[model samples]
Target: MSEDPDLFSAISSQNQTLSTISPERLTSDQATFELERLATLIRHYDRLYHDQDSPAISDGEYDALVLRNRLIEQNFPNLTRPDSPSKRIGTRATSRLPKIAHSIAMLSLDNGFSDKDVGDFLDRIRRFLRLGAQEPVALTVEPKIDGLSCSLRYEKGRLTQAVTRGDGIIGEDVTPNVRVINDIPETLAGSTWPEVVEIRGEVYMTKAAFSDLNQRQSEENGKLFANPRNAAAGSLRQLDPNITARRSLRFLAHGWGEISDFPADTQYGMMQAIKSYGLPVSDLLLCCHSLDEMLQHYHKIEAHRADMDFDIDGVVYKIDRLDWQSRLGFSARAPRFALAHKFPAEKAQTTLLDIDIQVGRTGVLTPVAKLEAVTVGGVVVTSATLHNADEIKRLAVRPGDRVLIQRAGDVIPQIVENLTPEVNREDWHFPSTCPVCHSLAKREEGESAWRCTGGLICPAQRVERLRHFVSRTAFDIEGLGLTHIESFFADKLIVTPADIFRLHKRRDTLINREGWAEVSVNNLLAAIENRRVISLDRFLYALGIRHIGVVTARDFARQYHEWDAFSKMIGQLKSMRNILLPSLIETEEKYRKRVAKELTGFVNIPNIGNKIIQSLIAFFSESHNQSVVDDLLLEIEVKSVHFQQQSSPLAGEVIVFTGSLETLSREEAKRQAETLGAKVAASVSRKTSFVVCGKAAGSKLSKAEALSIPVIDEMKWQKIVKNNGHISVKTE
Candidate 1:
């Protein structure tokens, strides 16, 4: 939780660090602290697999810790972090039931395990649409499921809400436990749909209904689960909707979120119009087209994923047009026209039986191993990832070794060998401090992790950053949880996140404490004064910087829309790196690439790269984290970003269109060239700033007339979006 300055360039001057080991390519600074220690061990296994359905590594070691925190934030993009587990998505709803907020950010998908990761997902959608290598594309595929995503919504067609993808921007109002599931429908059947939509999918549970709900929770001793996607997310988050109408939960659909119109125009005509509106989709969906029919429908849905009864783990694909997924948009979080693929990690062996460690909430440590219970694909394996102390000295693993492992989808398992590594059995060690505050745990130099200098007196990093500043994507206070933040931080009655908004000045000392009452301390002080107004991008992701998340705190609250211009742009990049550090402290790596080229010359927001501007200049250069963000800005009120800034004049054009038709419809001419901030490209290069053409045009209108570009035609691109996208185009 430190490493701010000296943005390292030494590790014995490179040439060997690249690890994840089997797969190794990250370049330097000891593999960027193994991508910030696999983003603090995949955010503590995405809070034990999406908020405690209990998973401690496996689905290919949580996809190799989100592909090594997405290849060290794609090759050192400013050592990315700010609580990153690759910009989290699924895991929130700290449940007691009701919570909803997602008018569309339920994302997560971007895997591919092999078949050349599906021929590099069709050569990255033909190089982001400038298509070529015999341009075919198409897609659709399906399968992926392994449940609990949800969504629903609809509107004039009925069934109004449903939620649960939680951390993808709130969720958990399981619309009365998805109204007794009967495969979800309550309406939309024959009403030409689209009066409003939403739809998304998965909810699942079926290996014989998770073995008859774990044989009725093992004859009512209750708590059983561990699979069928954690018994369909603990029976669709039940705070009792008739115990999720007796847990027979199921659903399918696949895609969609926040609609209003799009009844068709493609992702296979909107999942055949969301499968003609009766709900449930994926009868193994299909459509595909070349890269060997999407690897023969992902090996026929991984050879019928064990004779299917819900639980799939990989196939997905998507990209069956929809204006080429709005010109292949989105990447910081997912959906560059979808991909998934997965399935390949199911080996077995077992026995290790010991190694523990744990300690994360940012004190680092990790380790884990355990083992012996052994099952793998049928989900039983007791534990896996040992990712540090340099992978236990590259697996000289001890405690009765016998390893092997590997695994898929069941929460990313791993290990890959050490089957009694030459049975000598005695050298194991590792500890050297802070296994929970013995502190001074160090590690450094070519770091493979050992952290915990006990910052803020590590009671596990102050009760996990005050349970991630009241988590559900930060500052979502509501009934303040994580066991009332560790019973109000062990009776000191709350410590930070501005003392839970100064618990109404200890309203009668949390109503005379002890599981407090008086209407749960006035509903946790009206959910901490309904989050005292929040929103400058969840108050800069509830101030827990370090490679910042929530998409770089909405790209620095949409580029400084307030908190006094985002703390005056991190106090003018820390007073221009403290007025050039003592004469550029002997070429401090050329002033850290000249302060990431002065944050790409005035950071125009797009995941504010350069390692999130060196984690917002190392978190406002810490005067006690700027006095806990100025004591959480004197108990909250941040709210100030509203730039729906969409100027136009085809804001930096690059279109292409080709042999289209009369008026619009090449999907509204590429959604009117992406609502006029153009770039509809699918060919015609020379950074093509034009080339519309309608009547039998062809060869991208002779490659936009051999790259001269500007061509137009469909009535001069509908008179440049009827004069709104601005005029001044002469070539007819």
Candidate 2:
């Protein structure tokens, strides 16, 4: 028995014809040979650029080879194949994501860093296909945006869904958030339109916007983003679409994912088709008929990368002919189709000047290193997160140590490796007490953290708790912003949860407050009134109790079935404390020793976990804490769970999306689905039952096909609801 030689025979046949072509019209064999040659050349360059982050030749030179191959293939169209080098965009996405085979396989391009590299590439094609020097190599060059890669799908001339370039095989569906971008049209306008089209490009935040966003984060004591690329990635990956919508992000389509009945024979023509579809495409795309012309364009882009509004790592070159692209096959990861010639790392070295500690809402102390100004990837780096006391000690970094800081993933600036010599120095001891409140700080055994035990009594902790309680994730209390909370705290109108109830009584005082206008006071008061009654889960979460998170609170509410049961357990712990072993009462200079002994006993309760019990016992044992809890309970009433016992459509199901969608905003849609009982997830696999697809539905759609998941559409969804009796049929 012999191995199947179909693929090898195919390549050998193409190679024979590729060896003979000159300037005259190509025979069918020459066209096929040229296409395969382009694929092989492009795949090699793709690895050189994407994986090694190096290029052997200028992008323009590589583009010329692709263009030449494309021209030949145009004359011989029947030889086109699916894995061609001319049809795709961008590298296959990272493997950490669920794999998504593209709706269309993204291809790679050949590269040429010098005339030699360019000449060699052509020589191989010429020798393989029997071509001569008179046959000119042609190419196209374009800027490669450095940001999150994604695809947008349109159906029936309407913008429907967007997906990240997850693993080249599958991507997380993120249509809802992408829809909010003003630059991303909701509907493709034109009577004559492609039935389905997938536009692929990078989602980028402009440098100016990144700076402004980081500045705002800095002023508000929020986590400062490392760079625009990271900011864009983080913002788009958010589970909440509202966050994405508020970031003022933008999108530009560079190529297509899936095109139906596309009337294009070349890459240049395809770009024109994409633009005509009402999508934003770059105006700087250049067509070069010679390798030298392509190289010229590549140099021009490299010289002007920083001046552009968006960040670009390198230049992208593509083969122009659609037929040639098909003939060119693929490799395992990136396409054998296109290449991205990356610029050298924008990494520079600088000295560590000072280390600063900041307290977060969670009471975790973060250590930051102030750095001497240095340029990293075209952005100025002045500071980086040292992470914690342990991290600093591990590096033995002190003030004035020269450090090599690399922006991790070109986003967060981190001390990659200490470049300075270690000197005999004092150990950077973790703080023993909260810096702001002077309360004891303790690092729990086996945990990589030191936290302030001051809890809510610490003003920093207090302000943070107040902020969390009002944030969109928790109670979503309108009008109770940071300014209002700070003002109320200063005016003594609010100290604990109970003070919120008494705010109305101080209307005159609030109106007369320093920063409050009449309208402000009224609005604040009205917001409080509206939130007087809240859902059991939300109200429980708003308590800001130690060790009690939203998930834990929901669990407790479900188990205990009422706030009284939950509160009664807390009260019982207090009662038990009064009867503690006399040995535990020996509070001396060695207070932690005494506490640790008692902490062991606190963890013995069946349902009371160690973390919860520790936080509860700590809070209750502290002087004036019981009163705060008592006052809060007196001020507000927590509503009982109303819908827990009711039957719901999505009550226990876990759902995830992997493709583009069209029907509703993803955010509102997710919430609607969740409200009905579905648990929305980010990836797709065997666990997924239904996959809703829109235009350009990528690898996940295929995965759904593989897994035999029921794939449906917006109309099918309506019918499902109607059949399930979740919706009523209305008379037209």
Candidate 3:
């Protein structure tokens, strides 16, 4: 029920023994106990670092724990726990935020701390792929940033949702917060992107911004964050995203999650393509032909780490060839073709002065540690994070305790240990009331966080939700910036989204206000009017439904096509639920089956899972929400999305263009192909329908021939496009 002192003693004893004794010498009981201790310790730290933005240990210490656990697990394979830290990617989704199930899990990479480890990684890849020694193994190397991991999902070239890498399987939906980040594009650069793609990357804060933020926090008498990583994580996770918008957060795309189609055939090419699509990728990404080149790049990155604006813990090396990468597959925690070669963790000792609780926009209270100033790496550490009340209890930390601090990868400074544990000190307790609203702060059953029960009455939650409603991917009305929204909300001029549409009635009053003039007032009203005719997908997303992201909203729009039809269907389903399940008489199973049958059409839609279906049913079933939708509908026209119905013969075919074309540019040719409903592939594969070979066609043509795929000349390709795939051959 509390921090077990026995577990801590056992961990301390094992850590000492493991360093001196070989793993093979350890007994089975010792290995099992060590494994259990490591799992508990690692899971505790994972929650601190990932969920709470407060870490208690240094990265080096954590890595040491992991390495020790792995050694023991290897020695005693049968003693390994199912929930072992070695098998997990990150912590589970925080209870404070809504969760999103990733279509493809965002796995972490296996770490390589030394050059020998890197060489072993490369050797393992070669062995996995059954490559010959003479064959060149190309690898893409780039700096691995020390920040929060995020997944940005785009549908049809538009940014839809952004989520944290929570436990890999499910993540917290930070879409509204991410929309405010300037580095992330609202839409793809060109229309040639995949239909659906999830760009995986790090959301980081620059050292300068981190300094400025801490300075501002100090001046405002706010809780000072330990370092840039914590600042970035805290900023991105704010429920009131307007706060996140103010922070200087940057995103650098490293890889991808779920993708409909790949733009390139190699890792370097993929980075370039992703960069062209308006996502900021690392400019240092390089293609290496040999292990020596990879090591050279890694050392170069290490030398430049301190001078860079952002924090990078190490260099990441991944196989360049997509085909070879696919062949290599994955380990339980990471891809076999990739490895994160990490820099050593930087640390220093400091004194713990006090502990403070800061309430977030979502009402979750985070505990921050105020410490005596100490230098770690190049950054000055004035505070560290205790993480939670449980962590505080676990550490038994108090004011005046001399503690060891560490700048984990020179990013976030965290408490390593209490050096003066023998010194008697008063126990620190978490406050029972919300610091911001004085509302009762209660931790839910089976939840780690304490939340405010004030709901919309809490100013923080209200402003945050309002900001989300008018975000770029939502209603997106011009002139309604965060300042304006806050002003309007505070003045009681706008309480709900529908109030924005009804603001025309107050035009005269606004015009007479000190900050407002006739032109500005008219412009604001016009801007509101311009948004009167909106797309169905945007409308659905703007409603701020739980788990309903832009992609899901688009799915709903495409399925129903019309707002009236969608609304009608929802109403019908709600009515059926009410009628069929009239409590006492109907069995729950029968009621569920009846409701499911009535909603079979929606359930059958691709990618529409139980979560989305349940969210929709719940939203429509609520009378207040239905009234809000009805009111909003009265003011705006939700346009139905129309897709081109392709009748061309090339429709649904996968086409590849090779060599030089005389009649059309490659971009134009691909555009034309896509317009005709054909998918484009970069390389020749069994799935390729046709390989259009121009003059001097090379390996692709040969591969196509070998695969028995159709190979057409430039002249024939021109005829096919010109005649809408009704090709006619003429005698040469």
Candidate 4:
């Protein structure tokens, strides 16, 4: 059987470079030979781990091989091939289950947050179907179980094998371990059954099992698992089935993937049919007639979250009609017919025992709420983040106030809402002094949060700043984590951002430091050395400047191609504030316009606002801040980015847009193509193919391409979406 075109298409479009690679042209004989050998080895490993669930090599060793291949491919881009095994997510396919490639890629479902988000999903479905408000519909609402996703295959009315959901299409065979599951029947009740049925569900650990596992770990003096979700992931990922069999893993059939035939025409019917085959389907599952009913069902599930035997992160609602499900289809990574509504995390009520302020890496003082011990979401909660002093005042939460705490998706717990008594109020005031350096705290104009006057000298901020510098989103300095950064800060081996660049010079000093060994220090230094040339956007953000997030940094980089230009602009802004004070108070419009003109030269990129401008001014005005910049400049060199204009097949085309593109969202489609060396204009012009229409595609499609841009639908757009990050379409 041939590999599904949709699967390969998505893979190729996602990784255009990989699909286009030719082994013959990669190198002069010797290099090509090695590349082929390495590729073969990597693919074999992928199959071994992904398909068989048995890995011969450790993760570290595997990463080393992949990194080597990446380096080789980077240097010899011409020789690189798209089909290289390095692109696979998990273990490769095994021989079990007849290795049936999916007809449709078993895409994961997209997660939604609040009721509004769920409403939006329903709206999309309604618009897609051109349905009226009175139109009848039904939804299959099931618990979004937190577990290892696995695909179970049944053929000739018998349970054939089980496969791990590896990269959606291909999966690791966990047949041996799956066979032990008593609830999973070996044969169907009735003789008549589909030729093939791939049952998809989550394999999880119950609350009881999770508690026992943690207790055992505690008794052995081993590290306690953070949560049940992580515990389940760790257990299922074991290379040996014996290890898996020992773990009290439970499976719950939530849905089906590939089905040759079924007596039911709706999803709920098929689910019932599967349950008749003696599979363990939870009774909590509900069938709702409308979005409102679905939400109501979700609320009931959320109320009983703590009491549930198994852990569930959210509720999954699928279109009940199978025909509609097929028509609604899926995007590359997720389905369009269904959505997961995540519950507002379980909130624990606790007393605000104390309040403390901690200095961030950027010298921002964040207030921490020390709470009396309480359990939230099955995890013990003791503290929550207040965010800032304003939040504390807003909540009116004092030392004795009872607060509700919530944790989501393994993030830090936060005080969700205040339960402070108005009559017995103890109003908390914002601190005037910096907690770390004892410097005067001041809130810059147009900004709400107070910041420490001290810049890099603030000890608390140093470790955070250093961590941010090495973070994947920032400089991406490998081998440097929070522990290494904290250690270096305590030893005074690194204090400022500049120290990171200079640490390589004192290799012996770092190596000889307490708790520091030869190999670890060397690896850290190597990571630092590799990050010699920082990107413009990352450098801007790594400066720990206020009001600068990823998008802001990217905009700053786009506007000012050179670091010198940006630095000069910062200096000029500082000078202008002092020199042009009289001119600033003219008229609101005049003042804003004049300031904007000067600002545009330095910051005319998208999304730059008044709040950001104020922070930039405050940063440049401080002499200490200037000193840090000078110190950093001496040790670190900012690499100049040469923006090249590349010709793309979709470039310079006026693409007409319409509808809700299921594959790539409208904004995402525009952003993707624009990023991929293509010009994304506001409206369709003469040179547009690619109407790229979605459901309810509007007027633009009718407006003929004045310049000849070809219009395409979501399906065709999906063909180009995969390999190219910018080609990604947004699904609501």
Best by TM-score: 4
lDDT (10s digit) by residue, model 2, range 219-274: 98977765676678767766688988878788877778788877588888888777
Instruction: Give the per-residue lDDT digits (tens) of candidate 4, residues 456-490.
Output: 67776666567656655467666665666677788
Clashing pairs in 3: none
**Candidate 3 accuracy as TM-score:** 0.49
Per-model RMSD to reference:
26.4, 22.4, 19.7, 12.9
Order the candidates by lDDT, highest first: 3, 1, 4, 2
What's each prediction's TM-score?
0.28, 0.46, 0.49, 0.67
Indicate the residue-level lDDT of 304 in model 1. 79
Best-matching candidate per lDDT: 3
Output the better candidate (2/3) by lDDT: 3
Deviation (Å) of 211 in candidate 2: 21
For model 1, residues 1-732, the per-residue Cα lDDT tens digits are: 322111121111111222323223232333334554455455556666766678864566578567756755666554465657667776666767778799878888888788997787778677666576887888888888877788899898999888888788897788888989998888889979988899888888788978988898899898897778877887787778898888888888888899989877878778888889888788878887788888987897898788877778788888888887876776557777888888887788978878877655545666777888877655686776666777788778877778888763223366877977475456898898887778888875564667677766778677766765665556755556556676778877787778888878879977987767799789768867888887887777656665465555766776677788777777787777666553525576777777677765666554365766766777678678789888888878888877564698787677878884754357556766777777676878777777878888889898788867778678877877878777867733
Candidate 3, superposed: residue stretches over 4 Å from native: 1-25, 345-732
The superposed Cα distance between candidate 4 and the true structure at residue 159, in angstroms, equals 4.7
For residues 1-732, write the lDDT of model 3, one tens digit per residue. 233333343334323222223355443323443455577678777888898898776566667567667777777664556678778999886657799999998999877778898988877665555566778999999999989999999999999999999999999999999998999999999877999999999999999999999999999999798889999999999888999988889999999989999999999988888899999999899999999999999999899888999988889999999987775666567887898898866767888888766643345566777888887655577877565667678778888888887644211356768887565556777888877678898986554556677655677656655655665556766667657777888889988778889999998878887788999899889988989988887788778665465556776887788988888877776675567554677787777666666566544664565545667887677677677778887888889886555787677788999997765557557766776778888989887898888878899999998999888787777777778776633323
